[model samples]
Structures are given as C-alpha cells and as structure tokens.
Target: MTRKHIDCRSFPSEINCSIAISADTDRELLEAAVQHAVAVHGHHDTPELRNQLRGAIMDGPPTEEQPAR
Candidate 1:
C-alpha cells in the first residue's frame, strides 16, 4: 500500500500531525481520523491540529462490515 498527501489546514491546532490516510480519503474518513485525534490525542488548536496532520498519509482503505459468507 502507498500513501497520499492530505491538506489538513482546516482546524489549525494539532501537533506531530499526519492524517495517515490518503489524499483521496473521503470526508467521513478524514472526519473520523481527526475526531479520533481530537477526542483521543491532545489536538485542541491549529498548531496541534496541524502537527497532528502534517505528514498525513493513508495506510489502507477503510473496511465495511459484511455478513457471513
């Protein structure tokens, strides 16, 4: 799997930021990651947010649930 560039200059208060997702990564995915960081990590402002998203790159695509085959 490869990585993509994520422009996360939206919030502006993150640290050691990196989306760790892909550029093509959707809003829901991005939101989930950011929310996770904000909720879990100490991302409260622009810098922190930025850091938390600086090298943001996608590791793998998200997975959806499925019934037993």
Candidate 2:
C-alpha cells in the first residue's frame, strides 16, 4: 500500500511551519500530525481538529520543493 504524508509547508499558517509527517496508514499519520499540531502549533486537540487533520492528509510522498524566495 502507498504511504501517506502531510507537510506543514503545504498549509498556510501564521508560523510557516516546515514540519512533515508520514506513515503507512491514515491513523498513524493522524496521530503524529495531531501531536505536532498540539506541541508545536499550539492547537487544542479535538474531534473537529482530528477530522480536519485527516482531511489534510495526502497520499504518497510529499511534493518537490521549489527554490527559496
């Protein structure tokens, strides 16, 4: 099965976080993303937040980076 990943850089945030999380299953990815969001992003954990994180998950590897601005 293809792995899933979520890149903080792909999402627009006030902090412009660059963390990336990946896993073999959706559940694993969600768990890691939630932890990072709470610990690093100062986001409160909740059912709605989990759903949003799950929605943000992307299939396969992350996209290639463009040159820095």
Could you estimate the TM-score for every candidate?
0.36, 0.85
User: Deviation in angstroms for 38 in model 1?
Assistant: 1.0
Error of 2 at 2 (Å): 0.3
Q: What would the per-residue lDDT of candidate 1 be over residues 8-69, giving only the tens digit for each residue? A: 33334446333333444444445555665667565564665545554454345422422111
lDDT of 2 by residue, 1-69 (tens): 999988888667799888778899999999999999999888899998899888888889776782132
Residue 65, candidate 1: C-alpha displacement in angstroms: 23
Q: After superposition, how far is residue 58 of candidate 2 from its true place, in Å?
A: 0.9
- Candidate 1 has what TM-score? 0.36
Query: Over 4 Å off in model 2, which ranges?
Result: 66-69
Q: Once model 2 is optimally superposed onto the true structure by TM-score, how far is the C-alpha of residue 33 displaced, in angstroms? A: 0.1
Q: Pick by lDDT: which candidate is best?
A: 2
